[model samples]
Target: MDLDTGVALSRHDDHVDPFPVRRAEPAHAVPAGRMGYDLGAERLLLHTVQSAEAFESLLTTGTLRPDPELAEEAFTDAYEWIHRMMAARLPTRGEGALWFWARTRRKHLVDTCRRSRGRVLLTCRVPRERVLLSHFDEWHLVLNKGLGMPRLPGESEDDAFARWEEEHDDFDARLRAAGMRDAPVRDWPADLRTEIEKSWESIFDRGNYGPFECWQGTTHALNNDEVLEAVRII
Candidate 1:
């Protein structure tokens, strides 16, 4: 079967040295050229109801909203925990694109939370993108966009990566068969590359497609875990 253009992936060696530590960096910018989707009325209604219920629970219990400081700590810790938890389940269909973005964005979100002294706002995205949760940080939003593909119970990371690579090779074969292999690294068909070069939007429309929705929100409020969750799912 041909691999979906949206699912192109790169491979990494499993035998590489362990404990490859690197300096942490914050997520600097919103991905450019990604398109955003509008939630439908039904989704909006469901989310609205969910939000009301959650808030009601807090009110009924007389639970005071934590100082923005505590809330930030809770959110940041929860988000980081979730990110590692998901990583341990690696190579599961949508891990790369999802996790890569999450790893990058999480640093920024946490730093923003730490520095803001707890003055960030939180919001959630409609579930159409399969995101379990999301929030807007000061400058960007982190979304939990899960993938459409299901992960079978008991699948190991190695097994998952093996399967993904096999599928990738198969897709490449199909592309080659279609005479699209002449320039895998460079521009082959002028018209196609030209379209990609013209604009980021055009690149997404005509270049390689991927499985992710635009999770727009202020960068400050977005927690790293939420963003990572979205990236993995996507």
Candidate 2:
């Protein structure tokens, strides 16, 4: 299968239209690439979503939140609920399927973790070494999907790199269409870091958020400065 087909299917349109744009269907409901280890014919199936209202509701106003210590537990509860919801319609028995949600600059990411009950695998912007690896049972892996390039199965490493380079411009254009006007850090002045810190602090003060700590991925590594540059240009 063409990699672009899969890549296109994986990503959501980031562009913001002035008109009231009706939200598209959830990504998890659609067919996606299979993940996890396969045992003979017994392959582990998976799905991913940028957002899940069902999962979000369980954590936000549910009985799952009893105290600040149960923050991770709440996240785990949401994760499990999402898994079961997806697994019921999927072929796999939910033994080992993967699901992920990302938060680009949302400050509440950490508070979300603090109020959760179970473990949450947060992908944040900080370095991996700074994080407590023991909190998560499995160490997170970095998935490098360049620009608009879709992820394909069985593609050669060389081909994937070539595709990333060729499609980067398209990806950049797509980002521009989104409300993101400038690159992440370049757009920020010396005084703006204070605002970023305050945003994080506000979320920490409130116990109604989730964890989304930034760290280094094994496959692709980008420093904070580099990441900011890329986002700004987009």
Candidate 3:
């Protein structure tokens, strides 16, 4: 799928293998021949775009961490949830995370560069253990405070919510009736919140969503030495 255009790419009749198989030399300082043996599965080749200022910082500091100051309030909260989810579901290598497009197309990279006014395009090889992949479309549920339960056969989302509410005193339904908006997930019933967390695990399973092309990866900080290529897009 083209991340920028939302165009579907051709697929084979055979089942899709979510993991990539190509191998590469490990990042700088690793002993020769050790990578092939030590790094069992292939490392992900990912791309990300950043402003020139951020790129400069990466060069000066030798590592790039997520800048919360640059994110909007909603995104900041969403990222906090994402970080917590990552810590729980994946083996995080470092503090905080940086986002990248996993196995993305070139046109998507170019579009992202243009849209973000990004000056640097960073391509990195990261171990699978350090990354969490999620379906982009379904992520909106996390951002918008919507429940992600799968509706029962022939049931609508509203109907599912109605049935679910009956079991929980209709907490969310009452909130909606009172004209309140944006209830925090932390305020939800314990069991419901647990369900949401469980649903979030589906983000990592591309097969669960079926044929969605945009898969985002979140990983810990990346040192400049780990960056395979840093092209000036501007």
Candidate 4:
């Protein structure tokens, strides 16, 4: 299983649908990677490992594991015992300390991560005790094939890095071809609405719009075009 590196739909594409919409046979999706930074505990955890298998774990289950880095398991028991063990190592930050600057930052990160669901990976870990304010302030992450470089199953570190560079450049070319342009974001006008309705029926053979949110976002400078119907997103 390589990965699903499909080109996500963007808001700015001039044409959102193909001239002649035809349903094609399903095919194996390419593998893709997502990387980001995380403010964990009192340290900054930089996103480093993102394998197809790890991503699969996230896709299947919401929680991340230590080995495959992702897995499916019900927390019905709330993992009460394990929680206690961790609490022993790092006592829960009491309410009084909630007013502390560190706690405030931690809450921001936890809340945002929850809102983004499980698609995010925060790997860059830097301790607040050592990192300069400027570097810490520059913290950011993006989920796209062109962003992070994770070592493949058997590839060398250098080889994986090179592969990522090539992938990023290729992705840029596609965006450039689309003129890095997209349509304005607004309520779906009648014509666009009709196309979207068709998308629901044709794209997934379903009735309601399942991918509504996926195709929506503020238009920005990004390569996006519906003309390229043969786009093979990983």
lDDT values for all models: 0.28, 0.27, 0.61, 0.28
Ordered from best to worst TM-score, the candidate numbers read 3, 1, 2, 4
> Which stretches of model 1 miss by more than 4 angstroms?
1-108, 111-150, 181-234
lDDT of 4: 0.28
lDDT of 3 by residue, 117-212 (tens): 336667678877777887776677677655555446667769977875564345466556545436566665566667666666666665554343
For lDDT, the strongest prediction is: 3
Q: Candidate 2 at 163: error in angstroms?
A: 1.1
| Alpha carbon deviation, residue 45, candidate 2 (Å) | 14
Question: All candidates' TM-scores?
Answer: 0.23, 0.21, 0.66, 0.20
Q: Per-residue lDDT of 125-223 in model 2, one digit per residue for the tens?
A: 323321111112111100111222323567776896687566655544655665343544224343442333232222111122224332111111112
Off by over 4 Å in 2: 1-38, 42-156, 181-234
Per-residue C-alpha lDDT of model 4 across residues 42-88, encoded as one tens digit per residue = 65332221334444443345332344112223321112222222234
Which candidate do you rate higher for lDDT, 1 or 4? Answer: 4
